[model samples]
Target: MSTPVQLYIYDLSNGLAGQLSLMLTGRQIDGIWHTSIVVFGKEIFYGQGIMITQPGKSHHGSPLRIVDMGETAIDEDTFNEYLSAMREQYTADKYHPLEFNCNSFTNDCMGFLTGGSIPPYVTSLPSDFLSTSFGQALQPQIDALFTGRPPSGAPARITPSAATPDPALAASILQSVTAQATMGGPGPSNGILSMPPAPPVAPAPVPPAPSLPAPDASLVSPMHITTNPASFHNLLSSHRAVVAFFTSATCAPCRMIEPVFGELAKSKSKPDGGVGFAQIDLSVGLGGALAAEYQVHVTPTFLFFLDGSKTHELKGVNAPELRTQVDLLIYEAFPPHAHMSLSLSALEAIPLDPILFSQIPNLDTMFTKLAGFIDGVTAWNGAVTQAQVKQTLTRTVLPFLKASTATSPAQPPMASFDHWPTLTSSLIANLQLSELFPLVDIWRIALLNASFSAWNATKKVQEGPLNRFMDKALQAGDVPRNYLLTVLRMLANAFSNQVLAREVILFTRERVTKLLVDALLHDDVTVKNAAASLGFNIAAYLQKQRIDKVKARDDSQSAEENEEWETEIIVAILNAVERETNSEVTVHRLVACLGLLLRLSPYTAQVTSLLEALDAQRVLKGKLEKGGCREGGVGKKDVRRLILEVADKLCPDMAMAM
Candidate 1:
C-alpha cells in the first residue's frame, strides 16, 4: 500500500527575517525556510540529527506552509531501513545550516522515498543569502559554527560518508512513487551543519505589511514660477486650488511671509490634486499684466482660486489666517468621509502598508520557463525573442533588484527601461494563460521598485502591460490557481506606487473587485490568503483617501465607485470569515480588511445595514471561537480587538439587545 508523504515548511526566525532582511542583509527575503518530511504518521527532520515527532508538534511549532510530495510506494519496512542508514549519515555533529541542513536532508529523503525534490526557492535560499554583502561579511561566523569542534562541552563532530545510494534502485522507486516528481539530485552529501536557534514567537510567515511613506513636501518646488501672463493662466487652470501670492521684491512684509507661503505649498499641495502656489513678483516680467487682470492692488496680497476662479483674498502677512484658509479650501475641495469622526483606535493602529511577495525565486529557472513559453509562440522567432527577454532580465532587472534589496543609504541608479513594458506586454498578449505565471511573477517582483511602478503607471490604460495582464488573467473564465495567485500578488504590490494604486482603484475597480471577492471564497487556503491580501490593499487605499480627506480629481466618480463596491466587498469578507477554519493569517487579513472598509466609509448607514442583515457579529464571534486563529486553544488578542471594533461599528446595539 502507498503511504502519503508531506513536506512541512517552517520559518526559523518566525517572521523577523522578512521584516528585517532588507535592513540587515540588503535583500527582501521573506523567510528563512526549514523543511521536514512527514510520512506513515510520523514527522522526520534533521536538526540535532534525524529527530521524529508528531506533525506540526515539533519544537519548530506549526508549519508556515505544507506541500504534498505525493505518496511513496516503498513499504514501511523498506522506509525504516532507509531511515536507519540516514541516521548514521545525518548525525548531530554533521549539521551545518547552509552547506548541509534540514532542507538538504528532506531533499534527500524525498528523493529516496518518493523520487521528488523540494521547491527550488527553498533549496536555493542559502546561495541567494550569501550573494549579499552583509551575508558575505557573516561568512567567518558561519565557518566558526561549522568547524570540527561542537559547542563547548558537546561531543566532537562526526564526519558524514560521501557514499552513493544505488542508482538503479532510485530509478525503480521513482516508478513506484507517483509520477509528479520533476527534478533530480542526490541527498545527504557530506557537509557541515549546525542546529537552529529556538524558534521566536511565531507571527505571520511573510514580511510585515509595509507602511506607506508620508507625503514629502520636498517632492515639488514651493511655488510655481510665473514668468509670463500665459504661464500664470496655465497654472490657474491646471490646479484644483491655487493660492497666488501677489508680492513685490521691494516689500519687506512680502519677504517675511514668503517662507510661510512656501511651507503651505509643501504641506497642503500634494495630498489630493494639490493647492497650486504661484509667486507674482509684480516687479518682474509680466507680473503687472497678471496683477491688473486679477485686480490685485496691494503687495503681499493672497488670492485663492477654486476651479480656476478666485474665491478668497487676504492682505499682509497674516500667517495664521493663511493656514486656516488653506485648510478650509482643502476641506471644501475634497470633503472628508463621514465615519472619520468616530473613535476607532484599534483600526487606526493597523498599518496601511502594502503586503508584498518579496522572496527572490530562482531567477535562472524562472527565465528558462518564460523562454520556453516564448519559444512556443508561432508569431515570433523563438531564439531572437528569448535573447531579448534574457538580455533585459540579466543585464538590468536582476542586478537592479539585487542592489535595491541592499541596506544601502541611497537608492541605486535605475537603468533605462524603455524596452521593458513593451516586451512584457507583448508576452502577455501572446502567451497562453497557463504559461503566463512566470512572466507575471517577474513583473510582480519588479513592481516593488517605486520607480518601475511609476513608469508603468504612466502608460495609457489601453497600452499598460499590467492592465493587459490583469485583463487576461481575471477575465479568463477559469484561471489556474497559481496564475491567479501571482496576479493577486501583483495587484497588492501595485500599491507601492500611488499612481499605480490610483489606476487600480479608479480605473480597474470593477474587475479587480470581482477577482478579489471570488478569490476570497476560493477553496484553497493559499488562494484565499492571496485574495485577502489584495482585498487589504484595496481597503487600505480607500481608507487612506478618506483619512487624508483627499479625493480624485473627479470626486463624483471616485465616491460613486466606493459606494458601489462597499457592500459587495464587506459581504465577501463576512462570508470568508464564516467559512475560514484553517488559517489564522487569512482570518486576520480578512478582519483587517473588514475594519478598513467599515471605518471612514462614506456609506456608513448602508454598510451598517448590510452587516446587520448578514449577521456579521455572529459570523465574527463564531470565527473567534474557531481553532486556527487560536493558538493553544485561545483567541489571538489582536484578532479579537479588530473584530470588536468592526462589530461595534456595524451593529452597535447587538451587545445591548443580546
Candidate 2:
C-alpha cells in the first residue's frame, strides 16, 4: 500500500496588524512568521518541537499551503519512531531561533523518509533573518531568549502565556507551546488513547490492585527529595533535561498527584530512559531558599529543563498536563537519527569549490615579486609588514583582475608563474611580524588562484616556497593562532592540485601530514577548525593521486614503498578523525576524504592489506551514530552515508565488525 504524506503550513504573520508595523520607520512585520511540512497524511507540526494533531486547527489558520509529498517509507513503526525522535530534538531548550527550528526539523523528516528536501526559500529564513537590519538589532534578544538568557529589546516583554506576540519576538517564540494547542495528555511519551514505551524502573516489591487510587511502587521510579539548595541547584543544571517537582507535605493536591506522577515516570523507556523525576519539599529546612529562588507559592509544580536551562513550568495536579510535557521531555532526551542511504554516491553534493575567489589585478606583480625571492628569501632584505602586501594587492593585483573580468567575462585572469612559491624573502619578512593577519589572508587568496602548471614543465623544477616556510613555522614561538590558521588554509589550498600535492608529500617526507594533524589538536578553535578543513584537502588530493598511481604501477617489486606512503596518509586521516574534538563538519569532511581514499579500485589490494590491521568502523561509527542523521552543516548525512557506503565496499566480509 502506498502511504500518503501531507504538509501543513502556518503563517506566523496571521494576527499581526500590518498597518501599524508599516507605519513604523523600521520593521514592517516581526519576522518571517510561518512554519510547516505535512508528512504521513497527519499534519506533522514542529514549532516548539515536533508534534502531531488532528487537522481541525492550526495556530495561524489551517495551513495556508499544503503539498502532497507523494508516499512515505513510513511504516506505522517508522512513523512513531520519527515522531518520538522528533519530539526529543524539538524541545524548547534545543530550539534555536535560526539554527535549528521547525523549518529545519521538517526538512530533516522529508530528507529522511522521502530522500527529499524542504524548499530552499523556506529553509533560508534564518540566513535571511540574519541579513536584515532589524534582524541584526533584534538578534541578541532572540539569541538570548532561545539560549536561556534574558531577552534584551522587544523580546523582553514576551512571556510563556502572552495572548498576542510581537512580530519578531513571535519568531523567537516559534518553539513556544501552549496548553490549548496541546491539551491534557498522560504526558509526551504516552497518550490518553495510545500506549507508551515500557518503563525501565525495577519492579516494586508490592503490586497494587487495578482499583487502587495510586500506582504500585513498582510501576514508577522512586522519587528523591532535595535537602540542599546549592547542591540541588547544581544537580538540576547538570543534566541535559530534567523534571523537577515541587510539593509540600501538608498539601492535599501534592499527595493526590504523587501516585500519578509515579505512573508518569514509569511511562519513560527511551534508550537513556525517561525524564528524571525529583521533588523539592517546601516544608523542609532549606525550603525557604529553594522556594525563594524559584518562587514556589503553590504545591505540585513541575519544571522542564533541557541542556541546563529551565524552559517551561506548570503548577497543578493535572495528570494529562504532566504526561504531555513528559512526552516533550522524552523527545528532547533522545533525538532521532536521519539514516543516510548511499546506494552509490550522495543524493546531494556540494560543488567542489562553492566559494569563488574575487578578482585581483595586481596578481601578476605579486607573483613576480614572490617568485623573485623564492631562491634566497632568508638572505634578502626588505620591509616586511601587512601594509606592503595590502598596498601591492590593492594597487596592482585586484584592479587588473577586475578590469579583465569587466573586459571579458569568458576569460577571468589567472595567476601565471614559472614556479609557485608559498613564501618569499619579502613574504617571510612580513610574516615574521607576528601580528600580520591581513597580509596572511591576502597571501592565502593569491595562492588559491595560482597556476603551478604555468611553470616550465620540461625542467620539472621540484622546489617551491614551502621549502623555506617549513623552517620558519617550525621554529616560531606561540603567536596569534590565526597566523598558523592562515598558513594551514594556504597549504590546504596547495593540496588542491595532485602535482603540487605529490611534490609536497615527497619533499616533507610526510612531515606536512604530521603538521596538519598537530594543528587539528591546536588549543584555539579557529586553528582546530582550519586544520580539519586542511585534512579534507589533503585527503582529496591523495585520493586523486592514488587514482593516478594505480594506472602507472604494474610491478610487484615496488609494493613496499607504495604501501608505506599510502598507509601513512590513511593512518594520519584516521588518527585526525579519532582525535577530532571540535567542529562536527571537520569530522564529516575527514570521513568523506577517507571514504574517497578507501574506495576499492583496480589496484587497492596491495595497500588495502596495510589498512586491515586498523578497525575502520569503530573510530567512525561512534561519530556517525552520535550525529544521528542531522542534515546541513557540511552535509553531515551525506558524508556519513558515503563513509558507510565506501566502508562496505572496502570490507565486504567484515560486516559483523563494522
Candidate 3:
C-alpha cells in the first residue's frame, strides 16, 4: 500500500560478512551462495529483518511477498522530534556525523514506527538493500546531526570556523586557565573536552653556566707594599707587628729564604687580624741604602717591625730551619695571651733600638740592665771560654740566625770549621782593627789549612769583640797570600766606606799580582784556576773604577810609581787570561783585563804586547764572531766600537789599527 519500502544492506569486506552469516544462520559459514544479491557464504546479517508473506498470485516462479501495517506514514513534527531524540543520545555518547546505509536507517525508522518492535518483512530484506539510492541522499541528515543542538536541553555545538583565533588573545586565555587550574578552580574554558591538542611547548631558556671560583689567598703568602713608604708607617702604627723582607734576586741566599718568609707571613697571628707582610727588592734599587743601614750584608734577610720600629732581625737563612725560625719570630712579635709574661721578659732583653747600642747583649745582665749590658759588650773584651761562647751565642744570636735559616729550604748544611782561625781572621779584617795585628796574622795563616768545623766553632767570638780588634789584618805581612786575599775579599764587601774598599783593593792588587805570576808557572791546575778567577774579579773591579773615575787622587804617590803599578797589574791580568784553562773564567778575566788595559794604561809597549797575546790566541776575534758581544765580547760591532773608542783615547794614531 505504501510503495513497498525497499531495504538494502552492504558488507564492506567479505570476511566481515561471513562472520555475520554464521551469527544469523546458526551454522558455521562455508563458501556457498543462495541468491545473486544475498550470496549464502558472502551475504551476512544477524537477524536484522524478517520477510512477510501476503495472499497474492505469483507472476513468475515464486509468490510475491508484502509487508503492510496500518498508518505507516509519520507526520513531519513527529519525525523531527524523533530525529532530535536520536541525535541527543548519539551526542551524549560522543558520536560524530557519518553517512548511514538504507537498511540501518529503515530498521531504526521501523523500530520507531512500531514502537521499538521488529516486523516479519525485515527477514525478506536483501543484504544489498542498504546500497540503494535512498542511503546516498542521507549525507545532509548526518551532517546536521552533529551541527545543531539536540533536544532535551542538550548543549549547543562548537563549530570550527575559517577565522583563526588571535594568538595573543588565545595565549592570554590559556595563561588564565593555567593559573585557575593551579589555584584549584574550574578551568577558564572547556577546550580540554573537545579542543584539538596543542603542539608541545619547549621549556624556558636556562640561565648561563656558572663561573669557576677564584683562587684561595690564604694558602700562599701574599706580598704587600704601599706605593708610599708613609703608608707602611701608617699601617704599622695601627698594627702590633708588620713583617718586612729586604731581598735581591742577585743574592743567592735571599732567593732561597723567600718561601720560608712567605710561610711565616701567612701563619703569623695578628691581634686584630691587621698584621701584614711587606717586601722590598734591594737589587731593583728599592732599598739598597736602607738595607746597608740595617747592616744587611747577606740575604735573604728579614726584619720584624713592631709599632713602626724594627724589633728583631732574621738573617742568612738555609732550608731546614726556616719553619721553626718563622714560628719563633711570629711568636715573638705576637705571643699568645698566656705567654705575655715570658714575651715581656724576652722583649726587655732585646734593645728597643739595637743600632743605638755598640755591643750585643749579655745573658746575665740582659734581664736587669739590658741597655747597659749591650753598651758594655761594645767595649768589653774577656778571654771567653768555648762553652761560655756557645752559651752566649745560643741565647743571644741563635733566635735571629734560626729565623733567617728557616726562610730558605734549599740551602746546604752549614759548613763547619774546626777552629776559629778562619772566621776570626775574616772578622778582624771586617772590623778594620789594628790592635789585634799579631793575633790576626797568626790566625790568617792558620785558617788557610784549617778544617771547616774548627772555623765554625770560632764564628761567634770572631763576630764579637775580636771583630773590632784586628782592623789592619789585611796589612799584616805574616798573613798567608791566600788568606790575605780572602780577608781582602771580605773587607771589600762588608764595609760601605770607600776608603776601606780602596785600602782592600791596594792590598789585594799587591798580593794577587805576586800570586798570579807564581801560579802561571805552577803545574797545579786547581791553583792556576783559582789565581785566574781571583785575578778576573780584581781586574774587573779596577776596570769598573777606572771607567767610572771613582778613585781619589793621592799626592804622596808619584806619577811614575802610579804608572808602573798600573802596568804591572795589566801584565799580570794578561798572563792569567792566556794561561787560564777554564773557558768561562778565562773569558771573563780576558774581557775584564782587556777593558782595564784599554782604559787605564797609557804605555804603548804594554798595550802592543797585550794586543799581540790576544791576537795570537785569537780569543777576541773568535768571541766577536761566534758569541756576539752582548755579553762577554760576543757582538763584533760592540767590540769594534769599544776598541775604536779606547784606541782613540790611548793612541789616536793607532785608531785604524784597532
The most accurate candidate by TM-score is 1
lDDT tens per residue, model 1, 15-133:
76687677666788888788889898888888666776667766566899999989988788777766665565566665656555788678767766665667878866766766665
RMSD of each: 39.6, 25.9, 41.9
**Runs with alpha carbons beyond 4 Å of true place in candidate 1:** 1-341, 376-386, 406-415, 475-477, 550-561, 626-634, 652-658
Q: What are the clash counts of all predictions, listed in order?
A: 10, 33, 51
Return the lDDT, model 2, position 190: 30
- How high is the CA lDDT of each candidate model? 0.69, 0.51, 0.37
TM-scores of all predicted structures = 0.47, 0.36, 0.25
Model 3, position 550: C-alpha lDDT score: 20
Candidate 3 per-residue C-alpha lDDT over 1-658 given as tens digits, one digit per residue, 9 for 90 to 100: 2212222222222233245334333333321111101111111111111111121110111212223423334454554454443332222222221211222233444433432322323322221222222212222222343334355322222221112122222222222222211121122232122222222222222222222123222322223422123334444664666777777657777767777666666555342324667665554322455566667776677777766778777777754555555455555565432223232221122221101101222323322332232233444344543345444434533343233234362443335433344334333433223233333332332222223214323345333322333233324355344443333333222222333334434444454455456554345544444444444444445444443432322224322224566666656555554444335434443444455444443354665655554452243333444333334443334434433333333323433346
Where model 3 places Cα greater than 4 Å from the true spot, the runs are: 1-384, 388-497, 507-509, 516-537, 540-561, 602-658
Ranking of models by TM-score: 1, 2, 3
Pairs with backbone N, CA or C atoms under 3 Å apart (clashes), candidate 1: 26-405, 26-406, 26-407, 95-192, 95-193, 95-194, 96-192, 96-193, 96-194, 210-353
Which candidate do you rate higher for lDDT, 2 or 3?
2
Best by lDDT: 1
